[model samples]
Target: MTAEVPTTPPGDAAATREASERGGLPGAVDPPAGGGEAHAASDSALARVVREESGRIVAALTASLGNLDLAEESVAEAVEEALREWRVRGIPPRPGAWLTQAARHNALDRMRRDRRYREKLALLAGATVPTAGEVDERLPLIFGCCHPALSPDAQLALTLRAVCGLTTAQIARATLASATAVGQRIVRAKRKIGAAGIPIRIPEGDDRADRLDLVLTVVSVMYSEAHLVAGRDAAADRDLADDALWLSGVVAAALPREAEAHGLHALLLFHRAREGARAVDGELVLLGDQDRGRWDAALLSEAHRTLESAARLRRSGRWQLHAAIAACHADASSSAATDWLQVLTLYDMLLRYDRSPVVRLNRAVALAAVEGPVEALAEVDSLESALAGYHLWHAVRAHLLRLLGRDAEATAADLRALDLTDNQAERRLIVARLAR
Candidate 1:
């Protein structure tokens, strides 16, 4: 794992596919080769490990180096070296361990050469990797990045960067923003944290709610982007989704008394339970058309139990309400058997918590089922100005428009949706409509 030493490369192992989903956030580069594509399987595996283990790595390094800036820079440098070195020598058997070792070495080398971190060399020399059972700093790091002093966009960039291990480019795509914008936000946020001495650990008592709300919101977006964003790397998406769920569980466990924590966990579980049936052979399946038999019974049961726990708290939050809406669908024997009235009612109640256009757009879907496509289409039309940039808005409009026999208008809407998204699966659904 030492970059400076000459050692035999590990034998070639099967490398997973690189992320292919493209169509940058507002304006984006081609999806990052994640791990660069230079070495194929070796590079891909390196990228995956880095993304999956970054939070753990950063936490340990930052704790040891006692400088967040040094930890991040060393990791980034190690990655760059790995991209070159890994290509020559096959990826190591234990990618995370190897990466960690390399990053530690990288940190040591930086301290020796870089004047700024020189004094911290003693700390780095004695630092050991945190054991598995030791306190995991990821949640604290997430809570810290999401401090109220930073703007929402800044909070997102930092969490995804520090806690989720996403490169700025990946985060940019997720937020539908330019990379420059995301990078700048991250830098400014970091400086603010340093200058203001904003604590990264979770706050105690009454002050906790504000940041925790932001944490849950960020986690939700992370999970949603895994499914909603178009990508060819199903494995990458799965990894990201798995991490999001893990993050949710960690938060819920840390704050057992918090209703929204349980609610968020339950909501994610409900979604995860249905993930298996969400698509077939990479083609998107509408909720009404998904194979119900493919849903994970165990996850569904767990979700229900978690939701019950949240309900027992007698605290009504948006997370619980969203979980309730998901439960309505999860409980149905078939799509047609779903109680549209109840679903609509939940959305109506949800409006009090979140009146965003996206929520209204979802409400319109229920309206389509209960009041017919005409009413739903009207509701969707009202959100055009607010949601024009979002692919799902155009997609739902196309669905409602098509249902009402407005084929020509539907086609236009469908095309618009297609343009706004690069996700292959979503595009396929839209293309199929055009082909029909």
Candidate 2:
């Protein structure tokens, strides 16, 4: 099952409603008008252009305007205008340049009406549109979004919106928050940035290391959300993962000495290598059951080289540790040949940095592979209260129970997992297990 790289994952019912309420997120920006296959092709091209170019354009604008809200609003307006204008004018030879100029003009127009930004208007009037090479301006914008002053939730929301170009609804889905809550956080965050006079400039020296950690965390979350999609629009969902990879690569390039950035890129690439085998014929394939032959050899090789580079740096961050765990699987010729002991060790290291219940749950899975179901079951039982509503916990417990010959309890656990999950593929897998 070859995966289609998506620009945005298809939203749930709530995201759909929010899109309807707000005319649509910038991601859902109207496509070129008209009908027929030709028009459809044009619409897809426009969306691709907008998704690929908008972040850099917005980042460059924010770097100059020193305002996240203004830059995003201006770029969004310009993209919307492009949907209408580009359809008639045909896409410019240099779409990024054209959009930057248009977005700058829009910012200038708005700034002129408000004397509060008279100084900004003067700066923008002379600001040159960033060339292709200058689009890495996202690094500064990322720092601004991940500012320590904001709450972690606010920081994550702002990064996804301002730097990653995810919509409020997309963020809401990813963070498991309501669209209203996510939207409010983004609004409040932008307001705080303005009030606090936060500037979007990349940190230097020691400051760079501290802030890059925050940036990497946000990118990791974005990548995790993008990595697994069962039944959603494959093309749209794939793009979110692609963007995460792109952003992580940019960070690694910008900070060659940062082990965490390289580790993250390696970690994501390792997982992405297996994406092709995650689903088969539109059905979810369990990791152990996936066809290893389908995995991307090129990505696995890159991940190996990247992980080695990060390890050479001698600073083993959480991402690097996680990448090591992924390596245990990637290096295996088959599931039966997997080095479960090595995987278990890496999880131990990961727990030292991140003691979240989710990590513990994952560690329990590795424990089952090494020590037997009884020991792992004990660990899963301890997390019962914490992961009660988390479908995977129940699913893991069910697997353990089945292995232990506790058929009745296994059935009940599977039922609980089925009840808790929204993923159709997961539900189907559980139901099939029950049927068996």
Off by over 4 Å in 1: 1-38, 112-122, 131-135, 228-236
Task: Please list the C-alpha lDDT of all candidates, in the order they appear.
Answer: 0.73, 0.75
State the lDDT of candidate 1 residue by residue for 322-349, as single tens digits.
8898899999999889998998999899
Per-residue C-alpha lDDT of model 2 across residues 176-264, encoded as one tens digit per residue: 56779988998899999999999788878877776777798778777766644433422225776788788889888888888888998
TM-score of 2: 0.86
Poorest stretch of ten by lDDT in candidate 2: 1-10
* Displacement of the residue 109 alpha carbon in candidate 1, Å: 3.7
- Clashing residue pairs in candidate 1 are 15-41, 25-176, 26-176, 230-423
TM per candidate:
0.86, 0.86
